[model samples]
Target: MKYSFVIPCYRSEKTLGKVIDEIQAKMSEMNHQDYEIILINDCSPDNTWGTIRNLCSKNENIIGINHAKNFGQHAALMAGFHFVSGDIVICLDDDGQTPANEVDKLLAKVIDEDYDVAYAEYAHKQHSGFRNWGSHVNKVMTEVMLGKPKELYISSYFAAKRYIVDEMLNYKGAYPYVIGLVLRTTRNICNVEVNHRERTEGASGYNFKKLLGLWMNGFTSFSILPLRIASYGGSAIAFIGFIYALYVIIRKIVAPTEYLGWSSTMAVLLILGGLILLVLGLIGEYVGRIFISINNSPQYVIKNIINYDSVENKN
Candidate 1:
């Protein structure tokens, strides 16, 4: 079966070549000569695009995609999905830590066991403390927001059947969250254990701001749980306010001279006012995304592409 490998590259000029070499070596070892590698440069502030061009020049199976701007990793993956022509599609990090040599383990779940998608579960991740913390938050977010199974761990290194990729391609939102799309698409997914390696070149591209943006995308794009939570919270607060008002009325009637404290009243007003603003902001976020999507904002604009035909990208 033909395999398509899609890698979203950022500042990986130092490690891209080695990652490709390992993939080639593994494919050779497996006797899977009918494979293609697609590298997407997410407008990295490095020579990543140049590296992609060089790789494409040496091998016809390697394709290079240059983004017009830095649209995060999920958008880059969405861009790569447009050009895939394989029975199975595998996605992994451009950094060398994803263990390309052990991809067959993920492939086995899809090829041999007939699963739609298989994720790589690292037994012991080699990321920094900050990245690990972000991953943990992401895991919990997915479980709560996307209805992802608690046992199924999601990572960058994974293999998906062509049909699953096609299903994911059908999403047209400006903010494309890959994990949310996959979870909503099907439930027949599993994870395979793989070894994680430490970074040899640059650090992770994700910082606090980017992580917050990713989490917002997860919350706003595929789920309305955030809105629901706001609604429930408003209801609960209203009930409490009603009970407190009744108690105040009964107490004032019992003793007409009793002073309803102004400080307590101001505190309640400030807290309720803040909550109102928070709920309004959440609603505004959903509306803002809808407006952007309605305007047909492109997910990722392709600046240049090598070894690919002139086909329209469904951004």
Candidate 2:
């Protein structure tokens, strides 16, 4: 079967060549001559695009795509999915942390077991503390919001069948969450344990703001649990306010001369006002995404492409 490797690169100029070389070596060992490598540069400020162009020039099987601006990793993956012509599409990081030599494990599961997708599960991840925490947050969010199975671990490195990729492309919304898209598509997914390596180069691309935005994307795009929680919270708060009003009336009737402190009134007002604003902001986020989708926003804009003579880009 033909294999397609889709890697979303950012600030990976130093290590991307090695990753590609490892993939080539692995394919050769497996006797997989029919394969393609798709490298997407997500507007990295470094010489990543230059490196991709160089690789494309050296190997006709390599395809290079340059984004106009930074669109995050998930957007880059969606962009790459459009040009996949292989039976099995593999997605992995640009960095060397995801071991390319162990890709056979993931591919074996998909090919032997007939699974729709197989995610690479690491025994001990080599990410920094902050990145690990971000990954933890993402794991919890997927389980709670996207109905992901608790036993199945999701990572950036995974192998998916062509049908699964095709079903994922049906999502035309502006915000695309890869985990949510996969979970919604099929439950016939498994995990393969693989060794994670330490980063020999730059740091991670995700910061606090980007991680928070990713969480919001997962929350708003795939589920309505947050909105339901907001509704329930409002009802509970209203009930408490009504009960407090009755208490105040009882106290007033029992002791007319007692002083009702302004502090308590202000405290209640502040709490209710804060909650109202929070719920409004949450609603605003959902509406804003809907508006952007209705306006037909492109997920990612491609500035240039190399070795795409036969394939037409649909983005």
Candidate 3:
């Protein structure tokens, strides 16, 4: 069976070459020389594209994709997914944290046991505490918003069948959440424990800003549960207002000399006003994303492509 390794690269000039070497070595050991490695240079400030071009020139099996701009990690992955021709597709991080040799573990679940998707479950991650905290929140958000299995952990490294990749590509949205796409497709998923290594190059590209953007994409793009929550919140707030009004009426009747101060009135106005604005903002976000998607914004513009394939990508 042909295997395709899809790597989304950003500022990976230091580690990209070693990552490819490891992948080729492991694939050769498995006697799978028909495999292809597709690396996407995500408009990094570094000379990542130059390195990708050099690698592609040396090995015809290595395909190089250069994006017109940095469209984030999921978008870059989608760009690579569009051109992959493997019967089974595997995704990896540009960093060397995920050992290429452990890819066999994910492949085993697919080859030995028939599974549609396999995710790499780290025994213990080597990320910073803050990064781990962000990931934890992201994991919970996936479980709550997308109804993904609580036991299933989604990470950068995973393997999927060609059919799954095809289904995911059908999504034509500005924001693409990989796990959200997978959960929409199938429930036949497995998890494999793998070794996680420390970073040997530059710092992680996933910082505070990117993580916040990813969280917003996860909430706003794939799920309507946030709208539902807003509706429920509105209802609860209305009920509280009614109860407060009843209490005020009772106080006026029981203690005729008592006067309800402007403090309570101002407090109520602020609370309701804030809730109304919050709900409106959420609706506006959804509508804005829909308009952008309808406009047919290119997910990732291709600056250039270097590959030995028969097809040409000049757009």
> Using TM-score as the measure, which candidate wins?
2
Candidate 2 local lDDT, residue 286: 95
Q: Write the per-residue lDDT of candidate 2 for residues 1-315, one digit (tens) a residue.
A: 889999999999999999999999999999898889999999999999999999999987888999999999999999999988889999999998999999999999999999999999999999999999999999999998888989999999999999999999999988899999999999999999999999999999999999998999899999999999999999999999999999999999999999999999999999999999999999999999999999999999999999876333411
Reference-based TM-score of each model: 0.97, 0.98, 0.97
Model 1 regions more than 4 Å off: 310-315
Off by over 4 Å in 2: 310-315
How well is each residue in 37-147 modelled by candidate 1, as lDDT tens digits?
Answer: 999999999999999999999988888999999999999999999999889999999999999999999999999999999999999999999999999999999999989
lDDT of each: 0.94, 0.94, 0.91
Which residue pairs does candidate 2 place in steric collision?
A: none
- Candidate 2 overall Cα lDDT vs. reference? 0.94
* Lowest-sum lDDT 10-residue window in model 2: 306-315
